[model samples]
Target: MPLALYLLALAVFAMGTSEFMLAGLLPDLAADLGVTVGAAGTLTSAFAVGMAVGAPLMAALARAWPRRATLLGFTLTFAAAHAVGAVTASFPVLFATRIVAALANAGFLAVALTAAAALVPADRKGRALAVLLSGTTLATVAGVPGGSVLGTLLGWRAAFWAVAVLCLPAALGILTGVPADRGRRETSGGPALRVEFAQLTGVPLLRAMLLGALVNAATFAGFTFLAPVVTGPAGLGEWWVPVALVLFGAGSFAGVTVAGRLADRRPGSVLAVGGPLLLLGWPALALLAERPAVLLALVFVQGALSFALGATLITRVLYEAAAAPTLAGAYATAALNTGAATGPLIAAAALTTAAGVLGPLWTSGLLVAAALLTALPARAATTPGRNPEAAR
Candidate 1:
C-alpha cells in the first residue's frame, strides 16, 4: 500500500465525517433553528442531492486538469464549505453552506477513487479501492459517533467547527501527499461523456452494477429512516438509535474487509452471495429491532451484508469500466449517490401509507430481492478470458 493511499483515506475520513455528522446533530439543529425534525433531516438530503448532481458535472469539467490539482481543489472547497457551515446561524444560510460542502464532497470522492485506481497495479485494484473506501466505513463507526458526542458536549455549531479545523489537515495531506501526473488528457466535446455513458449503459455488467446500486439504495432508504420507525412504533429509546447505528457500522466494516478478499478471488460469487444475504437480513433486522438482543444481532448482519454487497458492486463497476476507468469511477459514484438520494425519498413515501416502519422495511426487502434477481443474469453473462474492458 502506498502512503498516498493512506493520505487519500484520511481525506475521505474527514469528508465522510463532515457529511454524516449532521445526522447525529439534527435534533439539536432543529431546536436551534426553530424547525421541525423532518425539516432538519433535509440538511442530509440537501447534501445527497448535491453529490448526485455535482459528481458527474465536476468530473466532466475536470477532465482536462491533472488529477492531483483537481483533487486538491476539491479538498479546499470541502474545507471552505465546512468552515462556512460552522459559523452560519441563519437556517437558509446554513443550508446553502451544506450544498456547497456536498458539492465539494462529491467532487473529492469521485477524484479520490480514480486516483486510488491509478496508484495501484490492475491485479491489486480491488484491495486499493477497498483501502480508500474504508475511510467511509471508519467514519460511520468512529467519526459520526465521536462527532455526535462532541456536538452534545460542545454544541452542534462547535461540532461543525471541529470538522472544519480537521479539514485543514486533510487538505494539507492531499496537497503534499498526492503525486502529480503531467499528462493532460482532454475529452473531445460532449462525445467523450456520451461515449462513456453509452459504454456503461451498453455493458451488461455495468447494468448489473447499476441495478445492484439501486437495490442497495432502496434498502438503505428504509434503513436510513429506521430511527424514526424504531422509536415511534418499536418503542425504542433514542439511546438505542446510536447503539443500532454503531452495530450497523461495525458490521459494515467487517463486510468490506471480507468482500475485498472475496472479490480478489471470485468477484462473481461474492456478488451472488452478498445480494441474497442482504435481502434475507433485512426482514430479520426489521423484526428484531423490537428485541434488544435480536435487534443487535440482526442489525449487525444487515450492516455487514449490505457493505459486503457494496464492496462487490464497487469492484464489479471497476472491472466493467476498465475501458474508460476514469469515467467508470465517476459513474460508480454518481450511481451510488443517485441511490442515496432515491432511497430516503422512497422510504418516506412508504412510511406515509403503511401502518408503521414495516412498510418501508418490506419495500426495502423487495428492492434487495430484485437486485439479487438481476445479479443472476449478470453472473451468467461473464465470459472466460474476456478482456475486462470489453465488458465495459
Candidate 2:
C-alpha cells in the first residue's frame, strides 16, 4: 500500500511493455531485418530464455547489493538494451540486445516480486502482487497495441526507443521513491543451492510452478503469433491487429483484477475452474480464425482466463515458497519465464508448417492440453476450495 509499491509497479509497466511489445513488432522487424517471420518470432523466445536463466542467476549475484541499487542497475541496463536494439541493423545484434534486455528484465522482476511481498502484510501478498502484475496487463492494453501502431507508421525502431525512454522515469522513480532503508538484509553468501533446489523440487511448490508455466506457455504461444493471425488468416488490416490486442489487453486487465481478489483465498478453485475454460479457448480461436468476429471474441476470452489462471499460479508459488524469501523471486521469475520461453519457441516451429500463422494457435492448444497433465493434481484444489489458512 506504500508509494514505493506503486513505484515498483511503474517500473514493471515499462518492463512489461518491452517484454510483450514484440508480438506487434514482429512482421515489421522481420521485413526490415530481412529474415523470415518465424525467425523474427525467435526474438520473443530469446528474451524468455534470458529471463529464465537470468532471474535466479542475477538474484543470487545481487543478493548482497542494496535493493535500490540492484533495481536501478537492472533498470538502466534494460533501458540501454532497448536503445541498442533500436539502432541495430543486424538481425543477430538485435537478437543479442533482446537477450540482454531480458536478462535485465528478469533480474528486476525476480527482485521486484520479493520486494513487493516484503512491502505488504502476509495476508495482503496476493493483492500486492496483483497490483504489481497489473502493470503487465495494462501494458497489453496500451503499450503492446501502441507499439503495433507505431511500427505500422513510424517503424519498429520507434517502439524500441519509446520503451527505452519510458525506463528513464521509472528508474528515477525507483531510485527516489523506494526508501533507502527499505531493504533486504544483505548476506555475504547467497542462498544455499541445496535449499534452492529443495524448494524447487518440493511437490506443492513444483506443482504451483508447473501450473503457472503451463498456463503462460499456452498464453504466450498464441499471443506471440496474434499479429499474423489478425492480419493474415483473419484477413484484417494492420489497424485491426492493434484493435485485437486492445481487446485482449482489456480482458487481461479484468482477469488479473479478479484473480488478485480471489487467489490468496482460493488458489485451487481458481485454477481448477479457470484452466479448462482457458484450454478450450485456444482451439476455438484456431478453428474459427477465418471469422473476424470469432477471432475478436475469443482473443478477449483467452486473455482474461489465461492471465487470471497465470497470476494465481504465480502468486501461489510465492506463497508456497515463503520459507526461502531470498530464493522466492528467482523461482517465481523462472516459473513464469519458462512458459513464456517454451510456448513461443514451439509456436515458432509450427509457423513453418502448412498451418502457417495458425500453427501457433494449434501449438498453444496442444501445449496447454499437454500441460494439463502437469496440473492433474491442481484438479484436487477444486474440492479444497481455499489454500490452507495458516499459510496466510
Candidate 3:
C-alpha cells in the first residue's frame, strides 16, 4: 500500500469515528435530547438511510467530477455537519445534521472505495479494502471508547465536536498527499451514467451486494444495542461498557487483518467456515448473556466472526462489480449502509416487544442465518461473455 492509501485510511478513521461513536453515545444522547431511547436510535437509522440513498445519487452526480475535489467536498461537508450537530439544542436539528453528515459520509465512502481499489493491483484490492476498513475497527477500539468516556464525562456534544475537528487534518492530507490523476474520475466510457447503472444493477453484482448487505445488517443489529446489552443482562457496571466495546474492537481488528490475506483467494472456503461459526455465536451470546465473563468472551468471538464475513462479502461485491469500476464504490457503499440502516430498525422493533436487551441477539442471529444462504458461489456475472445464467 502507498502513503496515499494510508492517508485515505486516516480520513476514513475520522468518518468512521463519527459513524461508530453513535452506538456508544445513544443512551446519553437520548437523555440529553429528552427523547425515548428508541427515538434517539433513529438518528443512526437516518444516517444509514442517507448513506443508502445518497451514495449512488451523489456518486452519479459527481461521477464526472474530479475525484480529489469530490473527496474534499464531501470531507468538508461532513465536518460542517458535525460542527452543526455539536451546537444544536433541538433534537430535530441534530437529526437533520446526521442525515447531512451521512450524505457526505456516503459520497466519501463510495468514492474512497474506488480510490482505494484504483491505488492497488487487482489481486490486492481485498487487502487494500481491509486496510481502509481497519479505520472502522480502529474507531471501534479507540474512538468508541473515547467517545463513551467523553459522553460519560464531558457530554455527547464534546464527542461530536471532536469528530468535527478530526476532519480538518484529513482534508489537508487528501489535498496534499493523494495524487490527482490516481484518485479521481476520468473522461471514459465509465463516466457515462447509463453504463454505470447498467453494470451496477446486473444480477451477479446485485446478488453479491445482497450477501454483503445481509451480514452487515446482522453485525449492526447486535452492535447498535451493545451498551444496553452489556449493562442490563450481562450484569456489568456502566464503566465496563467501554471495556466490552474494546474487546469487540480488538477481535474485529484481528479478524480483518487475517481476512485481508485470504479474502481474494478463498472467499467461499472462509465464508463456509466463518459464516456458520458466526451464526452460532449470536444465539450462544443471547443464551449466555447473564454470565458477564462468558458474555464478554462471546462478544469478542462474535465481533471477529461477524467482521470476517463482513470483509469477505465486501470484497466479493467488488469482484462481482468489476465491470462498473467507478460505481463499484457506490454499489458496495449502498449495500453495506443499506444493511447497517436496516439492522438498527429491526433491533429497535425487537426492543419494543418483550424481547428487551437480548432481542438484538435473536435479530442478529436471524439475519446471519439469512446471510449464510446467499454465500454460495456462482459464475462471476461481471465477467464478460460469462454465463449470466449460472445460479446465484
Candidate 4:
C-alpha cells in the first residue's frame, strides 16, 4: 500500500465526520435554528440528496481533470462549506452549506475509490477500498460521539469548525503525497460516461447497486435514531450514548478489516452470509431494546454486519465494470447515499404506527433479508470467467 492511500483515507475522515456528526447534534441544531426536530432531521437527508446527485455530476465534470487536482479542489470546497456552515446562524444557510459540503464529499469519495483501485493490483483493490472506507468506520466510532460531546460543551458549530480545520492537513497530504503522474493515469481510452453507464446496467452491476442501497437502508434506519435508542429503550444515561456509539463503531471497524481480506476471494459469499447475519441483529435489538446488556450486544453485532460487506459490494461492481472504475465508483456512492436518504423516511413511517422508534430495527431487518434474497440470482454473473466487463 502507498502513503497516498492513507491521504485519501484522511480526506475521507473529514468527509465522514461531517456526514455523520449531524446525527449526534440534531437536538442542538434544532433548538439553535428554532425549527422542529423533524426539520433538523431533514439536514441529513439533504446531505444525502447532494451526494446522490453530486457523485455522477462531479465524476462527469472532472472526468478530464487530473485526479490529484480534482481531489484537492474537492477537499478545499468541503472545507469552505464547513467554514460557512459554522458562521451561519440561519437554518436555510446551514442547510445549503450541508448540500455544498456533501457535493464535495461525494466527489472526493468517488475519485478516491477510483484512484485507490488504480494504484493497486486488481487482486488488492478490495483491500485498498477497505483502507479507504475504514476512515468512515473510524469516524462513526470517534468523530460522531466526539462531536456530540463538543456540541454539548461548545455548541454544534464548533464541530463544523473542527471539520473545516482538519481539511487543511488533509489537503497538504494530498498535495505532497500522491504522485502527480499516478494521479493522472486512469484507464486510457475508456468508454464515455453514457457508454459506461449503459454498460453498468448488466445484471451483476445492478444487483451490486441494489444490494448497496438496501444494506445502507437497513443500517441507517436504526442508526439515524441511535441516541434515542440508547437513552430511552436501553435505559442508559446521556453519557452512555457515546459509549454505545463507540461500541458500534468498534464492531464496524473490525468488520471492514475482516471483509477486506476476504472480498477478492469470496465477495459473493461475504454478501450472502453477512447480509442475513446483519438482519438477525436487528430483530434481536428490536425485541431486546429494554434490556441494556442485550441492546448493547446487538448494537455491536448490527454495526459489524452493516459494514462487513461494503468492500465486497464495491469490489463486485468494479469487477463488473472494470474499464470504467471511476464511473462505477460514482454509482456506488450514489447508491449508498440514495439509501441513506430513503432509510429515515422508512423509519419515520414505521415510527408513526404502534412500532415506535424501535420499529426501524424490525423494518430494516426485513429490508435486508429481502435484499439478500433478491441478490441470489446475480451469483452466476460473478463467476471468474464470465465477467461482464471482460466480455464487453
Candidate lDDT scores, in order, read 0.71, 0.86, 0.85, 0.81
Q: Per-residue CA lDDT of candidate 4, range 174-288, in tens? A: 9999888877734466676778778666777777777888888787778877776777888888677777778788888888888898777777677768876887888889899
Query: Candidate 2 lDDT, tens digit per residue, 1-392?
Result: 88998998889999999888888988889999999888988898899999989998998787767899899999999999999999999999999999999999998998899999888888788898999999999899999999889998999999999999999999999989997787754564545656765787677788778777887888899998899999888899989988999999998999999999888878777777887787788989999999999899999999899889888888878877876777788888998999999999999888889988899999888877876777785565323333445444
Give the clashing pairs for model 1.
none
TM-score of each: 0.89, 0.95, 0.95, 0.94
What is the per-residue lDDT of model 3 for residues 1-392, given as tens digits with 9 covering 90 to 100?
A: 98888888888889888887887889999998899888887888889999999988888888878888889999999999999999999999999999999999999999999889888877788899999999888888888888888888899999999999999999999999888886657747454667768876577778778888899999888988989988999888878888888888888888888888888777766687888899999999989999999989998888888888788878877777777777788889999999999999999898977879888889999998987665545534212222222211
As for candidate 3, its clashing pairs are 67-184
The whole-model C-alpha lDDT of candidate 4 against the native structure comes to: 0.81
Better of 3 and 4 by lDDT: 3
Indicate the TM-score of model 1: 0.89
| Worst window of 10 by summed lDDT in candidate 2 | 381-390
Off by over 4 Å in 3: 189-191, 376-392
Segments of candidate 2 deviating more than 4 angstroms: 188-194, 378-392
Write down the TM-score for model 3.
0.95
